[model samples]
Target: MSENITLTVNGEPREVEQGTTGTDLFGGDKAVLVMRIDGELRDLFREIPDGASVEPVTAQDPEGLAVLRHSAAHVLAQAVQQINPSAKLGIGPPVTDGFYYDFDVAEAFTPDDLKKLEKAMQRIVNEGQTFNRRVITDAEGLEELAHEPYKCELIGLKGNAANAAEGAEAEVGGGELTIYDNVRRDGTVAWGDLCRGPHVPSTKVLGNAFKLMRSAAAYWRGSEKNPQLQRIYGTAWPTKDELKAYLERLAEAEKRDHRKLGAELDLFSFPENIGPGLPVFHPKGGIIKREMEDYVRRRHIEEGFSYVGTPHIAKEDLFYTSGHLPYYADGMFPPLDVDGQNYRLKAMNCPMHNEIFRSRGRSYRELPLRFFEFGTVYRDEKSGVLSGLTRVRMITQDDSHSYVTPEQAPGEIKHLLDFILGLLRDFGMNDFYLELSTRDVDGDKKDKFIGTDEQWDIATKVLSDVALESGLELVPDPGGAAFYGPKISVQARDAIGRTWQMSTIQYDFNQPARFGLEYQAADGSRQQPVMVHSAKFGSIERFLGVLVEHYAGAFPAWLAPVQVLAVPVAEEYYDYLQDVAMKLREAGVRVEVDMSDDRFPKKIRNASKSKAPFILIAGEEDRDNGAVSFRFRDGSQKNGVPVADAIAEITRVITERQNTDPTAG
Candidate 1:
């Protein structure tokens, strides 16, 4: 008689044969791609331990999707090798929405090459080869993967995979080395690769939902010091429909790309003479920027924040005092020698803010001291990562710092959170979720973060509690916190359901102590104050980029650079429209009249292309009636409105900050 073992399967107690595997427990469910045993994902074919907690991981789950993509990457690598036998493997890892496998080949892959590889990969997927995992020693891994120098090097760094490379953790980690072999029905190994994985049972799980994206040159292990390799990117989905949906989203995102809109609208430009990652806003762009700054500055003043300013560069020792020099040194520009001392461009404004706080004495009555600034800071971002305004070297931050007693930290954080949410809503971003970023206490880089266990726990709990109280969906981001403290970041989704990290409220317990900042408590004893850092718009440049994409360049009337453009229906109506434009300009509207030799229709087309929120048209009927036709975005028109009513309606939309098309109703 076969013995049976008791197990908790998906939160239910069950009995199965002692040697039962995940494949046996979940074989009937085609949606289940893998199994989670004691919180770790495992292959379905792996045997389950007695009394172990087992849960089915479906392809719809995030982890299972990653496993599916990783398996597809292996198949992709196999297809590459089959075509180009001389190609050597680097590393293949699942990234956001897809997977990429790097190869050391003689030639870069072309579009035709990708199509050929897709066909080859489809054949492998049809073969339904089983993914068989095998454990091996370091010596065996080195010997078996000798032809792949990159793999051999990764094997050599098995235990310290975190320090090895960006994606090396997907290949080898602090455990016994393993290799996954693609086994055919004849019990013959078709291909294999060194990886630490929990893959799906077979290539069939990938289905026909995978596609080869494109190929690019990437440095081995993500370092310029290493050899460059041809990296092929691909994406996989659970079903064909999901893949199609993802492709559609990609198309939509491409249409809404901010860089393309910024150039087409002549809003901003990254001139080569000004250097990469530095954007110079055109006059039109400057107007929008000014409006945003003016609104945010007024809101800050109303929220009890004192406006302040700080220099662009400061002594390097000041960063060391704030614990940014040694920890965040890489993000800062190289130090400049000034007056026999090292002066560095500020990558952050908190250190200087701390100096301002320490420059005075405080009492508990003024516990929540808030200081705000529109500080422009510089960072040494790599050229590879720079993407127009989204990722730039020069960033204008609406940075603020609040110093409070330990007991007052929670309330102050909540206040900031409310402020941030309201500010985002004012800009038409209503969808939001909060992220609680905490320290990674168990990670190898724990030493990089400085704080006592008790301090970190207290700070994290305060932020977590306040974020939960806000009633927004909270997501946890482990290892994403600043070196000094934990943070609550507001993640706002744009019009297309894409999330962006817009604002942040960080609970800092270390900076106060590092700077020796203190306040007199109610008991008349000196107590260390907790410092909170908040950025309503993380950076003006990045926020503007996001806004451009969110609105697709058709900004609301309040934010539009050219709020109203008056175009005459004929050359004779030019004087009437010019008069209307002058009236609008007097009413504090950014209005312009088209008085050029272009045709009336051409002028209207130009106004539409400029993305003006409201267009005023005057003709013979309007000239006699003392009215104008109000044309808006969306090709809708409201005709024959009195000039006074037209002006009132336009000014009302702008004053109310209406984000929708004014004439949509």
Candidate 2:
């Protein structure tokens, strides 16, 4: 007879057989794909222990979704190996929104091959294959996976955590080695993978809600030194409807892909000769950039920020003082040896700004001194991470640093937060939330962060209180703080509901002391003033990229590169349209006459394709009546308006920063 034991399940005490498996305990509930035993996720096939807290994890839970995607990745790898027995597996890891499995194969996978693999995966999913987990010795793992060199190498690194690579987390970790066997219904193992897994009970739970997205070349373990492997990317959802929704979002994201829109709109380009992650803004893009700079420059002046200029490169020791070297060396360009001194392209502007604050400073009255600059900086971004303007090596930051007494730090942070929010709202992005990044006090990781315990505590509380007082939802991001201090980053959602980290407000106590900055206090004692760093438009190039995607390349009237396009209805009306264009230009509107020899309809088509906010059309009737027709971006027209009214309307739309078509209103 089997013995019984009491277990705390879902906050309820229950009696079950001593050797009850998770599947049997949960009675094979389809929704309960996995179970949490005492806080640790375990395979359903693993027997539950007596007197343990148990909770069912459904496919909708975040952890369960990861397991689902990871299990699906295993199915995909099994299908690939079945089709090509020579193919060897490297690693399969669950990533954001999906998972990807790397395989060392002789031939690159094509689109047709992906369809074949999908069918094979579907067959495996229908097989109801049970995933059996087995604990094995490291030597056994190595011998079993001897044919797969990558797996064997990972097995050798079984207990070493520091040397583990990105995808290695899915295959190796913990004190023990384990492998997951895909057992067929006939009680025979169909395939197996060396993994640290708590997979779903059966493959059939994957249902038909998974898809193979695409394939790309990826280095094994994300290291450029390793051999390149073909990586198959895929996504899995709990239901078909959810899958369809995710696919729709993907389609929308593809439509808003900034790189494609940038070229089509003639905004920017990344030339091969210039090097990766470096972009050249065309004339049209330049206009938008200039407008942003002009607006911010004027605003900074109003906000009592003294404009300052810094060089593009600085000596290496300055960064060591700011605590960036060694820790942040990989992200910085290699230093240049100049006259026995090492100079590096500036990767951050704070250190130089700190120098400016310490150049010559005194008195309490100058306590809240603020300096702003459109400083250009560069980072040694890897080629794989570069994506047009969004991830560029060269960046121009609207960087500002403020020095204030400890008592005044709170007020300064509030002012900066308001400035950032207003600036984002002006740019047509109003949805926002604040994320407070605090230092990780956890073991080992804590050493990566600097600053005394009191300093960190004070700075974290100040940012947290300020963010909370603003009534914006504040999310905690532990281990996300900069080396020197804590920060609050504004995450703004755009037109398509995608969040972009826009501005940052960081409080630094370490740098101020490191630089030995001091100011005379009102009590007649020298003290270190708190240094706060703020970047309104985190990086101008990246901001432009976000805006391009936010508006899908059809910018607001005020932000549109060419605010007005004047097209004549015929050759005879060209001179009349030029007269109207002159009036618009006088009204401070960016207007140009389309004098091309193309026919009127084609001219209109060209203007529409340009995505100009306003199009002015002139014809014989308009010339006779001293009027012109207004064509808005939505293909709507308000015809036969006097030239004066047309000019005033266009000027109003542009000046008011209208995001919608004027005619729509």
Candidate 3:
């Protein structure tokens, strides 16, 4: 030993022998899954440097969970290759809350195959194989991973990776290329993968807390043009309890899946002829959509927005003037030739709004002009990425644009941010945080962004300051901005704690200039106006989808397609129930009488299934007393309320926008 060296272990100075590994420093704490050496995560078995500040990463911490999941991914790959020797490796990267590995196999994996793989993985975990890191040159890596064409490709991109998608970072990003080998206690190599890793010390750290999820077909690197492969998804946690909890959450999420609930509630449908990503709202769904539109439109009028209408398609030259032609051509539908001119289905409303601003204007008094529209735009979303209404081809944006002088940019951004937050709150999505998405100034993506360097700097800082001043949590999303400008997005958490990007406020200095949008300034000078783009609901279709899941289809009374279901206890009480429903209708409650031949209990069950907020039942006693019984969504009831009083109470709830069953308390 070359003498002892001083190191700071959890803020306490300690002397350890030179070249002592982090595992030795934290030998007493088995729960310390990994160690952070000088603010950088490193393998516990890696040696610590002199004067290095080391901190233990417990199994419950985020970084520790990532390590556990990634190590579990490696074990999964090993199990797959062990079961099928010919299966070539692709990429196995950790994702949000889980990890998945892609493999090129002759046939897709079956459920039985996954079961076998899980058992094999557990065995490997119990064996406690050591994960050994080895630095290798490109030539050496290429030679070692010759069978893995995908890995070889990643090796070629060692320092210059073009992956914007998740999971690709595990292969290439930083300085050097390295391979991690799974070494058995007997000095025999069990398995390995080419990775830039800081994994847990051994397979034993994975424990029995991992379960192999289902497998699916995935393109090699998320590119449609790339080779397709079979991908196995798996989830790992620090303890079996956490794994059980995650599984329970997954079960709940599956039950709340909008597609399933949409069919059950008759809210929406995707017909075979309508094409994928195109959904047709049923009458019930249309009611919800219309209510949303009406509320947003009222808010726009109150907020001083000039409601404008634009055609669905525009001349191709219009997009070119707004910089969408060549840069955004991939995301836009191919142009239609009309009279020797090209016309495109608009992918965004901002370009058209710019055209409206430039149509005819010349006064400083109209400097901060705001335009609003429920503009339906079309986008060529990749087939693989399309899901229900959330990722549809035809999106209806509650889009608005504000054209202001350069000096008023900050104030206008703040105003839009406040409007977006209030709108989300009104829709019952109260839990929110702000995300500032700015240009990727330091990366290869700079060329993809428009506007001068000075303009980008000013726009980013202004948005950031406005976001920070809102007193909400601000998360930075570099490289997530649109090509034209930086943006602030509202991220709202739903009922089950899943975050959704609900609204966005983008600041643009390029498009106005590009479109030659000008307004006279206070000094009597023509100035290129700054543009602020905002979509309170992002898209009506998407927000409806989110709410369907958020509320589990039990919309509040005001938003529910049918607010009240009136049921008669007996045939003789039909007239009484109908009278009560008529009174409710007069009170602006959406009431429907169950005049069907079904029994009273079945009628109640139908109301429950429909998720109507209120159920009014009139029986012989109620008819004699001129009273109605109330049944709420949660199967609770309050009987013997006067019919007039019942109508007043129900209307009051709806008018007050209470997002709960009447008897929820």
TM-score of each: 0.97, 0.96, 0.95
lDDT of all predictions: 0.93, 0.91, 0.88
Candidate 2 lowest-lDDT run of ten: 656-665
Q: Provide the clashing-pair count of each candidate structure.
A: 0, 0, 0
Model 3 misplaced stretches (Cα beyond 4 Å): 6-15, 50-55, 59-61, 147-149, 163-168, 172-175, 223-226, 663-665
Higher-lDDT candidate of 2 and 3: 2
Pairs in steric clash, model 2: none
Q: Which digits, one per residue and each the tens of the lDDT, describe model 1 over residues 1-665?
A: 88999999989999999989999999999999999999999999999999999999997799999999999999999999999999999889899999999999999999999999999999999999999999999999889988989999999888889878877888996797999999997899999999999899999888899999899999988888999999999999999999999999999999889999999999999999989999999999999899999999999999999999999999999999999979999999999999899999999999999899889888989979999999999999999999989999999999999999888999999999999999999999999999999888897667778889999999999999999999899999998999999999899999999999999999998889999999888898999999999999999999999999999999999999999889998889988988888899999999988889999888989988989998889899999999999887778888999999999998999999988766553
Model 3: per-residue Cα lDDT over 1-665, one tens digit each: 38999999899999989999978878778888789989988888899998999999987788888878888999999999999999988878888888999999999999999999999999999998998989989999999889888888888776666653357678665677889999999989998888878888788878888998899998877878988999999999988898999899899888889999999999999998979888999999999999999999999999999999999999998899899878899999999999999999999998888877888966779867999999999999988889998899999999999988888899998999888888888888889999999889888787889878899899999999999999999999999899999999999999898999999999988898888888887798888888999999999999999999999888988899998888888889888888788888888788888889998788888878988888888888899899999887767789999988988888888999876554342
User: Can you write out model 2's per-residue Cα lDDT over 1-665, one digit (the tens) per residue?
Assistant: 99999999999999999998888878568898889999998887788998999999998799999999999999999999999999999889888889999999999999999999999999999999989888999889888989999999898887774476776878888667899999999999999999999898889888999999999998876778999999999999999889999999889988889899999989999999999999999999999999999999999999999999999999999899888997789999999999999999999999998888888867889979999999999999988889889899999999999999999999999999999999999898989999999888974568778778998999999999999999999999998999889999999998878899989999999888988999999898999999999999999999999999898888988988998899988889989988888888888889889999999899999998998888888888999999998887778888899999888877877878766555442
TM-score, candidate 1, is: 0.97
